[model samples]
Target: MRLIFTLLLATSLSVTGNARIFYLAPGGSDNNAGTIASPWYSLNRAWSVVSAGDTIYLRGGTYAYTQQTFGYMVGKNGTSANRITIKNYPGETPVLSKGTGYTNNNEHWRGGCYLDGDYITIKGLHFAGYTQADNFVWSGLFINSSNNVIVELCQFYNNGGGLILEGASTNNLFLNCDAYNNRDPNTGYGNADGISMKFISAGSTNTVRGCRAWENSDDGFDFFDNNGYVLVENCWAWRNGFIPYTTSQGGNGEGFKLGSTNSFPSTVLRKLTNCIAFKNRQSGIHQQESQCLTQLYNNTVWDNGWDGVNFHYLNLPHTFINNLSFDNDIAQVQVSGNSTNTTNSAGTGTNDGGWTVNVTAADFITLDTTGISGARGADGSLPVINFLRLASGSDLVDAGTNVGIGFNGTAPDKGAFEAGGAAPPPANQPPVANAGTDRTITLPTNTVTLNGSGSD
Candidate 1:
């Protein structure tokens, strides 16, 4: 009997020592234990209680706040082996909103949540209704000075800005997120971008992948004065620089503002891969005065207000390959300085050399943009759409110089969506499953548990 009691106690201690799970809900109380049945009331309570390797699951409901500066500031750090996770309860959406009665200041920045912690993962939460009366620079979530953070499967809308990463934030990832409908009324719809990563030092290596941004007042994705190596992959941006539900245009309006004018030249390093930009008010991809070498590969830009790609800042050693630029109001690609421009659409750079190809409406399967803003998949991936897919018999198929990235057929196609390669597959495919390793059990432990968590 004593041996059994000791074993049970040891098991309990081991479980608690390794990791813990907490719960948060709209109607919970700080005084109560943070169990699934009796959760905490606020994110602040969770921040005060959680530790490394802990997870806090927020329940479905609107968590309204009236804070003037920030609703919640998460400052706890986690280790590389075990990250602190804040996620919504499965199958439910938890929304964080800035309620009425919050003071608005144009000079100050307001945020619904501020993440200043390292090695954290925040997923499947919605940040909405965080706007000010004036043209205050606000964000649904602000990541400041954080490292090794992953913010995935989140939504940010109707805020002053969607998400902003700044101030020494390094090695962060924003994956499969959406930002839309963010406008600043007082600034004549200026200063509200879908996502902006600015003011970080070089070598930060922040990345954004599989994300979508649309209908923001300012640029879709802005890397303004960020002296870091930033990457944007498999992303889409459209209809930015216009007010939501209206034709009125505002702000700089570039779909992907790679970099703005920098006081210190050649400070930014950026790479774009498999991205699509369309219908923005300004240039599709604009690099203004960023004299650093940038890489543009397998990107598609069409029907933008200004040039498809305006890399006019005299940056040396830029690389433009396997890109498609079509139907912009200005030139297809307005570039200067030195670049390795090859395997792209005709007339892309000063010394363009590639297989000749012309893009027209007949070259694409569809250009309707109907399902661009549709619902995401169940696993929080972007919806697969037919927009901008190369037609079956287009000359662009297998016509690109391989830049070592993965490709199908003899060579990669010259656009964001590869002809029969990386183009999104049809919906409703069966999810693949995986069972964990096999284990042997003795007579005392005849029953053994298997881990299936790694299955998709």
Candidate 2:
């Protein structure tokens, strides 16, 4: 009987030991047990007690901070099977704000949340009012050295910058997020971006999907000095590089700044697909000295202050397919790279090697810029709009080569959206393995790197 009791107890403990739910409220106390009714006060308290499979639900309210460096820091690790989740309570909103009096030294930076945890998920939180007038800048959510972290449905506004992932962060996903109105007065509205993924380690991959960035001081999305593969899909950026409601010039207002460094030797391939960038001060998509391979597919850019698509670099290898660029201040596509171009629509490009069709206002249902920055759907998807979708019988339909991504008609459509069909499933194929090339190792060498890019 004693053995039977021990066995049953062990089974029960094994089933329930790993997972626990903690609650955080703006008015709660840390001395409580973190229950739903008696919740903890701060994210710091939750971070101190959470383990793998543990969840911290933040109740609705303002969580203000005055710290010079980090308002709240998370340095925990969860497993692959069980992730640590810090999310808003269902049907409620949690806002994280920095104190108005927050000021640090001229050399120091500040962040509302510093997340360095692995395998964590943060969802449905709003980070706002994180501005500082000091010489340094601030980030709403700063993620560093973290792997497999997921940040979804978050909004960042009125801050120095938005979400920034850097320094060896790998495989992190930012989904259904919005970053706008982020300006840095210290640099004359420079050095602030909606999403900045910089200095990531090589051989790692990060994804940003279904996000929006607008009216930020700097670029909408800046991938500066990253050596990893970044996949950006279904995102939008507009009206950056200018102060809101004013003509004051902001920072370098490129919509998507795809990397800047030419020093890294890794095969860093950045891919952007199904994205829209418009009305920026600079080029919509600028490949700023990223000598690595970049793949741009099914993107749309219009009404930019400079070239719509700028890819002038040192004859770097790039791939542009089914892209549409029109109505910019300067040329449509500025290409100096040795890129594979196919079935694109551009006006006045320096290299018109791949120009196929001419896209005009007649090709779209509505050129009116209305409701582009409206509210998102309940499921946090992008706002459905007819701003740039291809009209019926437009030449852009079925005018693209198959690039492995799914298409609707006999071939893929030219721009970001297919003209007349539901979205298709991903390409179905057999599993193929690629172990890179054969390498000859010296006697003293202990290891060698293998290539997996050929694998699908």
Candidate 3:
């Protein structure tokens, strides 16, 4: 369904008379009036004369891109109040495809669905299969637009990377998007990622809220080399830096990697709250650059290969409040290089350098969240999962030092979940069950049988 969003962004966009609504469908003709009954044949035709305050609705269909001449939803500006919206029609999907033989030159050659516009809204779209090749060139969606753009309810999978919003991209909002299965075939310089919004312009910031990134070849969310502050809230990342789709070896993986590995550190601050990072190949959350200030609040992380949440290289102090870490291979907090860890809790003993609470996994209702994605509420907010919810009467509840945020009980909880925070109102969802019983399964046609691993 189309969302009723307010346009309160601050920017300069030309006043182009009044708003217009254009329509595009698979079977539309260029000669049509761009109306619902007679939509335009291509996005190029609809956006050719589109102005500020105009809205373009893409009808449900598979819009495939060609390498010979790629398609771009490019250079259509909209104002703050009356923004331009290019979105899928209500209750429909617009699947954008990078057709067979997707090459590496889309980043340089510009041969795919490219997004380069300001103050535009893109929603309820899926992109597929823009992979292979190296040099970190092409991606499913290339975004280098100006300001106040909103990318929502979009899915990018099996691509080189999901989206790259860089190069002076500012004040962009990414909400409820999922990026997975992005891989680089070139092992020499593998950097296939999910959605990276680094290198943002000075005095411009980007915010990612209610996003899910998982199972990409590289890091799930990369905000490296950014000069502006990046705020992330209520997001999740898991199984990154490995091919979750094909179960293959992925590139340099980290769940949420803040700052850059380059010589120069990021020149801005980063804030994260109510996020979860689990099951990633590398550290669940890591900051490469020591100079950048980081603020972490009410985050939950577990079962990662390295440290659940690490900031060992920090010489400058940071804010770490009410974050939780458990079941990671490395120590709860790595104490190195003038570190000052805060009152965060790790299941293991938290006595390294500045650790405080030694909260254990038993304090949580459940330790796993294999089925926690997209189960929040009708609006797709943070899920109230049995996985990692703080147990009643546990020391973690109300044991956290106050961070000026609201509390459900007497005080704030140590982790993301609060004891008395109400769950989402009831909704109509199909029942689901997961189990891992030892059994043999045989394909009916192939007559191939395999044994179960007896795990869930």
Q: Which of the numbered candidates is closest to the native, going by highest TM-score?
A: 1
User: What TM-score would you give candidate 3 relative to the actual structure?
Assistant: 0.83
What's the CA error at residue 400 for candidate 3, in Å? 1.3
Question: Model 2 segments beyond 4 Å from truth?
Answer: 1-17, 68-70, 100-108, 263-268, 348-353, 422-456
**What's the lDDT for candidate 3?**
0.73
lDDT of 1 by residue, 1-456 (tens): 011111112332323456889998877887889999999877777889778889999999998766544346556898887789999998799998877676443223555677788999999999988884654677888888899999999999999889999988899999999999998888788889998898787767899999999999998999888888889999999989888767787788999987743444444378999999999998888886675778899999888887788875755567899998888886787775566788888433221234244777777899989989999886667777789888899888898989877888889998998777554654554445444455454333323455543322
Which lDDT tens digits does candidate 2 get at residues 1-456? 011111112322322455899998888888999999999877877888889888889999997755544345556898887888899999899998867666453222555677778999999999988884566567888888899999999999998898999888888999999999999988788888999899877778999999999999888999988878899999999988887446689999999999865555336478999999999998899988786878899999999998898886776667898999988997788775467788888754443446654888888988787999898876678878798998988888898888887878799988887777875334444445554456554433333455453323
**Root-mean-square deviation of Cα positions for candidate 3 versus the true structure, in angstroms:** 13.9
TM per candidate: 0.87, 0.86, 0.83
Tens digits of lDDT, candidate 3, 317-418 = 666778888778876665444444556777774335455656777798877665765544555565556777888878888887787777888778888777
If both were scored by TM-score, which would come out higher, candidate 2 or candidate 3? 2
Q: Rank the candidates by TM-score, best first.
A: 1, 2, 3
Extract clashing residue pairs from model 3.
none
Model 2: per-residue Cα lDDT at residue 174 = 98
Model 1: lDDT of residue 276: 95
Q: In order, what lDDT does every prediction score?
A: 0.80, 0.82, 0.73
Model 2 lDDT, residue 20, Cα? 93
